[model samples]
Target: MTGTALDAATTELLAGSLRELLASVSAGGELGPALDALGWAEVLADDPATATTLLFTEHGRALVSSRALDDVLLAELDPALPPAAGSRALLYPHPAEGADPAPLDGPLWGVLLGPLHGVDEVVVPATAEGRTVLVTVAATDLAAAGGPATGFDLGSTWHTVAGPRPPGSGPPAPEAWTRAVAAGRRALAAEMIGVCESALTLATAHTTDRVQYGRPIASFQAVRHRLAEAYVAVTAARAVLDAAWTAAGGADGGGWAAAAAKLQAGRAQAQVMRHAVQVCGAMGLSQESELHRHVTRAAALDALLGGHMALAESAGAALLAGADVHPVVEL
Candidate 1:
């Protein structure tokens, strides 16, 4: 799902441009047209790793959600499939579900979760009886079947649909779905990193500005300790994720690599959120603060593809089963 390497300077430029664009879009702008005007499709064709990292990281920073994930998942699933004519969304597997859960499960999450805001149609990939079924369903139809769920995450552009799979079905090429899952896992991991990092940044700013007892909370050792730990968690997450990116691009058994990335990112998300909220106290829990957005978004993203505990347990099982353990970061 992730490949192509750009020189450092080029990557930096790309990151800058992406940040500017995403920041604008996050403020108030249309996602598809803005990305098209910026030639996002071309950039994706050139370097997927750069595209996923820069764009999704900004998505985390600005709390912007876009259908850009469709590009990542669909490209790996079936590149030959042409883009849809109308606005569309791709529903993916939810966090609670297993690798291949029931097709009609209530929570119809997506490969790239969120950014499912305005699309009228959706591409749902359902697995059953060892066959992969790709169905394009009307979003309105899903709504008619009970619409989206207003769950814990009110800030994210998450649409939880529940419905039946349309008529036709057949399995795709071998390992196609597996590859798609790996790609989605890595992409979500990038976004989670952005969310946790932004949360930490927000916490730091708040602690520095909010004063109590004639001093800023940030100056206190207790607050400083929490923020410091959050930083370390974020840094550790990014390190493992970079290796996953490398494994996905060139090395074999990227499944484990991607899993590792998501696992660490999930753990980091919880750590960052816990300390960030604690440092900000009651204000962090308030909807007025930006921390809650990251909090809820991280919750949903962590569950998508795989959660920290789920992946760790699975990783342990794989090791015990004698599966090839690709600790891409191996010494």
Candidate 2:
């Protein structure tokens, strides 16, 4: 096969693997172990960037990998989660006491909040300055230290693994942190594409099965038009994501592409999920039905790290301030 064909085949294989991994996780399998058994951990360790792209090919896979990335990059935690190893962890630039805390999913090993700079206590409205430090504390330690409470209702249990900052650890480089955050937004865009596609599939299936006036609902012109529109939106979003992924390899325009991709993907996911529910009627909201999972996951992702509108505004402001602009499709 030609190089392009080989790349296409590899992407297809990775998508299939991610789909199976999602199904397994839905069937009560542990995500970390499943990823390891599938050799994804080795892939991540070997080629972190490619592994990120593969993981983002599916919503469940992306969700697991994104959470794991926090530990792998920020805290230097073990990915295998061995008996001696701690559970998956989350890291955020800690907000001030009484200020709203950032939302998180899954158990946290501890919370690292700061620009410490040799301070003994966390100050309100922390900012990065000279000799910045990150103060770490377990979830329980928050209560003992009188720190502000932080939690998220992502339908998972988050436990405290340890307490206060590790010795000899300092703040991460500003560029590294910025790259990690950008990569996370791109991963979210990929997950949005997966969710939108899944919803479109469910909608298509339901319309084909449901009969109205002696004909399948999908046979109707209006139904077909709506579905066609959704398909277009999904296609556009996917193209944008692919472009962004490619652009990310370049040093100059990657952030701009990622932001644009995220904005478009978020909008596509919202529209697709809404249309899917409408097509499925009351059945879509039923707890026993699989459609709800896609909708719920889309909703959760939409709220993460600022939604589409926020991303658009940020991108717009950056562009206005002399940031480079690039076309989504180059002739």
Candidate 3:
């Protein structure tokens, strides 16, 4: 699906609220219900903030935390986590033990814990700078979401993070990577759209002003056709992006849909932006021209989210292998 740019106001609010959420979440007080108030998670006592800024080093083998998670526990559910490298203020989640009331040692834990389900099914907090932040975790679909002091609703299940990585293995969970890929896709799509729109605008304006045969190039049938083709391509890509968003909206079967959206966006965005530059002619290639920036942005997008060609090939194969595809919705 095409990604919409988050407005400045919304970005600001999320920034502020995210910091507050991190504070309350990291505090390890009554969870579940509190997390429900945030769009990040649902289920009473099912989520606890275990947000941390993690860096993936050397094929995801080493994860270094920027913050201190000493107050929380580390459950290490996946067991695929790599050894930690450097350390800052780091908190981690631990699998819930028995009824022993143990005080958190402070800024360090062996095992890790995380919110098992509800709300954060699609989203996880990671710093944009790829540095330090808070972390959280919770259990899904169980009355005793916690111990005697904690109880969680059982029927609901979703996804999000909880704690630090384990000492062995490499990288974090597949889910974390999945979320990162999705974010990268959204960012790429948004950038592509921006490029396509800018190219169209530039080409349209230039053709209107550039005269050939005593008339503007805009009057030429060939130029008109080029613009129309580019517009159509942009529209089609936009549709696919919209479909991706619908597929991601609290739906359980978003995996293939997400893949398809990214794949389509990757192709169409590349094509439309390239055509935009071509239609703009020599002026488009000029360093001073905004068209060049758009072209560069589009290229950057093509490389992000595991590269467009690879992703599209994989998605196409999945579709050919009888994987169900979701239809795009008009917005």
Who wins the TM-score comparison? 1
Q: Which stretches of candidate 3 lie over 4 Å from their true place?
A: 1-172, 250-253, 327-331
As a whole number from 0 to 100, the lDDT of residue 140 in candidate 3 is 27
Each prediction's Cα lDDT score? 0.73, 0.56, 0.43
Give candidate 1 regions above 4 Å deviation. Answer: 1-4, 26-30, 79-88, 104-121, 136-143, 250-253, 327-331
Lowest lDDT 10-mer window, candidate 3? 52-61
Model 1: how far residue 88 lies from native, Å? 5.3
Two-way TM-score contest, 2 vs 3, winner: 2
Residue 38 displacement (Å), model 3:
18
lDDT of 2 at 18: 75
- Best model number under lDDT: 1
For each candidate in turn, the TM-score is 0.85, 0.70, 0.49
The TM-score of predicted model 1 comes to: 0.85
For model 1, what is the alpha-carbon lDDT of residue 119?
A: 62
How far off is residue 66 in model 1, in Å?
A: 2.6
Residue 140's lDDT within candidate 2 is 34
Candidate with more favorable, higher TM-score: 1 or 2: 1
Candidate 3 CA-lDDT value: 0.43
